[model samples]
Target chain A: MKTVIINYGAGNIKSIQFAFKRLGVDAQLSKDPEAIEAADKVIFPGVGEASSAMHMLKQSGLDRLIPKLTQPVLGICLGMQLMCNHSDEGQTNGLGIFDVEVKRFSKAVKVPQMGWNTIHNLKSNLFHNINDAEFMYLVHSYYAEICQETIATSHYESEYSTALKSDNFYGVQFHPEKSSLAGERLLKNFLNL
Target chain B: MLTKRIIPCLDIKNGRTVKGVNFVNLRDAGDPVELAKQYARLGADELVFLDISATLEGRKTMHDMVLKVAEQVNIPFTVGGGISSIKDVDDLLHCGADKVSINSSAIKRPELINELADKFGSQCVVVAIDAKQIDNEWMVHLAGGTIPTKHYLFDWAKEVESRGAGEILFTSMNNDGTKSGFANEALAKLAETVNIPIIASGGAGTIQHFIDTFKIGKADAALAASVFHFGEIDIIDLKKELKKQHIEIRL
Candidate 1:
């Protein structure tokens, strides 16, 4: 399988690569458009500020190329926020893969909703072998508001979309790479799909 | 709501896990990678690997060990001990560590914390404080809890958060390895003082100790080594007990 992890220099891509390697799949980390385009699957992962990540993506022209990716593409954490129409973080606009806007959690609650939380109301094949009430690791301050494209929802002071799927583009707000067995199953489901 | 976290700390020296792990189902007893995978299977919220190796060659060995563990484990793992600069953090993160914990170096030059937070986001930075209670005041210790500093524990914790630290791992040297319990009073004080989450480390002996750390200490997480390393405490059973006690744990 030719899987390419879009590296725009925003967050740690090495862990994601290692996760794939353990699955008996050798995934490639590439910024070259040709490698990304020719891949059977593309994983868009990020872990930094939305505005800066967007700037880096634009600089590398991945911002323009990402939304055009026809293969199955999965965005994680900041990658998920960037797949939205816009984000409250630095007031940045993102790829319109999902028609949703990212908003910061209320100051009334903890800003960075760290630790494990369960995802339910599953609506995608990405959760094939995963059961409901399974916990996943999450660390983010901003979250995408619930939308029609939402495939899974979680709660942290309020209901929000934890996973979203719009056509070939899929995004998960939590770090499946850091989430244990169920997370591995979810990634395998994505790959199989 | 986000649940309380349970983290098993492993001491790695010269590329191998020290103090032979005695978990019930551990495949390879002294292998960090095998232990990591077993911990993830047992539903440990996270893992912290403390590199006790001091020499340059040992550091290289530690890096190779981290790469091996990362290749096998799929959960968040943190690397700490002897991390001195941006390059060290860069190398570890590049080797697939999810986060890097800064200790003595962060105290020697406080600006190192800011530099790391700037280079990698604060979420990737964890500031570990080793403190020894002195004269009714918890004084911060440097150089692996040997040299004492003038900074107070609560005050430095607040400063670490303000300076862009993602979280604080507070280890009470007096309470560490005692196996009686965690210093809940000091942990509560630090938790109240900092807006960021506080990970309470040291002196965890029983499952009830973990309970007290979360409820009384108000710690976001609890870290222990010996009890977990020696098979005295089972993480899954501990989580089940925490859940029964309404401590809000991931089961």
Candidate 2:
């Protein structure tokens, strides 16, 4: 299977690529819209600020193509946040894939909720065979509020959406690539789909 | 809520893990990739690889080693030691490291902290400080604790946080390798000074030491080398103890 990771000249996608390789899938990283559109699957991964990432996506012309994708496309970390309606990180508008907004965690909890946390209420096939009480790695200050599109929810300072699923589109707030065995299994499930 | 992290650090020289571990089970203790795999399987939250090598060639070798480890180990890993510039951070990040730690170089050019944090988000930059208590003052040391600096532990920690460093790794020079305990007093002081997460390094001989580091030290994470490397303390058992003590830890 040809899996192409969206490369918009922002953030490092090496770990994401290695994760797929470990699953015996050689994924390609490319900014060319044709290559990404031609692939069997596409992964949109990002780190750093939302506004800058959005700006880079726009400059690379990916902003116009990503939301239009019909095949299964997964967004990880910042990529997941950017797939929402908007983000408060830099007051930037997102791709409007998921009808939700990302907001900063209040002073109730730590700013950047780093480390392992459990996600419950697994609803989508994206989490097929994934059991409850399984820990996924999360490292973000902003979270997508619970919405109808939320496929999974996690408890932090308050309950929020950790994963979102729409028709042919999947997004996860945690880094499955860095979450060890459980993560590998989730990727395998996604690939088998 | 985020669980407290337990990190096992590996000191590498010329692409091989530094030797001083007394574990006989590890036939090739110098192999970092093998040790990394072992730690990940043991339920370690994260891993830090410190390249103690001197020559440029050795640094290059460490980069290659990072690639191998990243391919096999499925956990967030941080690389430290001899990182001097944005180029250094970029090279390591490109090699698949989750985070890059700067110590002596950060002290030499404090602005480097802001530079790195700006280029790569603060989450990717970690500033490591080696501190020692001298005359009732916790003074910062440079170049692996061989030299002392004017910066105090609390003062420098606040500065690093204000300068946009994502996290601070504080190691007590006197307590390091002693296994007596973590410098809780200084750790508490530093934690109060910065809102960012503080990783307590050095010491940690027993499971109770880890508990105290979180409870008393107010540390977000506890880091150790010999205890985990020499099999003096098993990570899974230690985490069980931490949970029993009411400290939140990933089991």
Candidate 3:
């Protein structure tokens, strides 16, 4: 199956590509709308500041195209935050794909909330054979609040949405690419979806 | 809950993985890619590659090694040593390193932290501080804990956090290579000083040391080179012991 990872000069996309490569899938990195639209699956990846990333998306016109795609699309890390309705980081507006608002984690916890955290309340085929409370690597300051689209929840300061699903669009606050074996299984599940 | 991290740091010199005792007396470990894959399989939460090479040619080899490791290893890893500019970080991150830890370079130019955070986001920027207690003061050191700096440990930590560093890796020269324990008192103070995560490095002799680092040190993560490289402490067993101690480790 042909897979394209949306590249808009954001965070590391090579790791995502390598993750898929290890899974025996040669995922293409493309910023072109046509290539992304032609893929069997699309990955929307973002890293860095939200406002600037949103600016790059608008520059490349991906901001308009991504929300309309019908194929299964997975957003990872900042890409996941960008899929929400809005983000508190840089006061940026998101693509409104997940119907959630992203807010910064309270100073009560670490700002970035680095390292591994467990995701529970699994509710989608994206998890597939993966069990509940499995740990996934995460590094982010902003998180989407738990809502109707929330497929998974993790507690840091409090319970927040770690994974969101709204029809063909899916977003995960954790980095499945860097999340080890259980994460690889989730990517495989996305492929089979 | 976010689990406390267990990081096995691999020191690289001329493209090969080496472990130095007390920042000197180097010993070869194995291929970096092979060692990284082994550590990931063994349940290491993350891995750090510190390129101790002093030559320009050796730094070039690190780029290739980073690419290979990123291709093979499933978990997250950080690349450090000789990284100073945005171009350096950009090259490594493009090569697929999840984070880049800056030490002496960041100390030289504090704005480097702000530049990196603004450019790549703070999540990818790790400011590693090497400090040791001198006259009852935790003074920051430079050049892998060899050269002393005027900055205090707590002051530098808070500065890095305000500068937008995502995490701080504090290695105590006094406790390092002792195999006795980590600098729990200093580490706990650093954690309290900054809201960002603090990774405690240095000492780390036994599984009990790991427990103390988390419980007493209050470190968000613990990093050690020799214990893990020499197979003195098995990560799986260490994590199990930490979990048994109610330390919230990934097992």
Best of the candidates, DockQ? 3
TM-score of 3: 0.99
Worst window of 10 by summed lDDT in candidate 1 chain B: B20-29
CAPRI level of candidate 2: medium
Tens-digit lDDT track of model 2 for A49-78? 899899999898898899999989999999
lDDT of 1 by residue, B169-223 (tens): 9998888877889999999988778777789998899999998999999999999
Residues B6-116, candidate 3: write the lDDT tens digits: 999999999999988888889999999999999999999999999999999999999999999999999999999999999999999999999999999998999999999
Tell how far residue A112 is off in model 1, in angstroms. Answer: 2.3
User: For residues A1-193, what per-residue lDDT tens digits would candidate 1 score against the true structure?
Assistant: 8999998897889889888887888999999999999999999999878898999999999989999999999999999999999999889999989999999888676556778999999999999978888899998889999999999999997999999999999999999888887888888998998
Candidate 2 on B6-112: residue-level lDDT in tens? 99988888888763322112223558999999999999999999887789899889889999988899999999989999999999999899999999888889999
Highest lDDT among the candidates is held by which one? Answer: 3
TM-score of 1: 0.95
For model 2 chain A, give the 10-residue run with minimal summed lDDT. Answer: A106-115
Candidate achieving higher lDDT, 2 or 3: 3
Q: Report, for candidate 3, the interface RMSD.
A: 0.5
Which sections of candidate 2 miss by over 4 Å?
B19-28
lDDT at position B209, candidate 3: 90
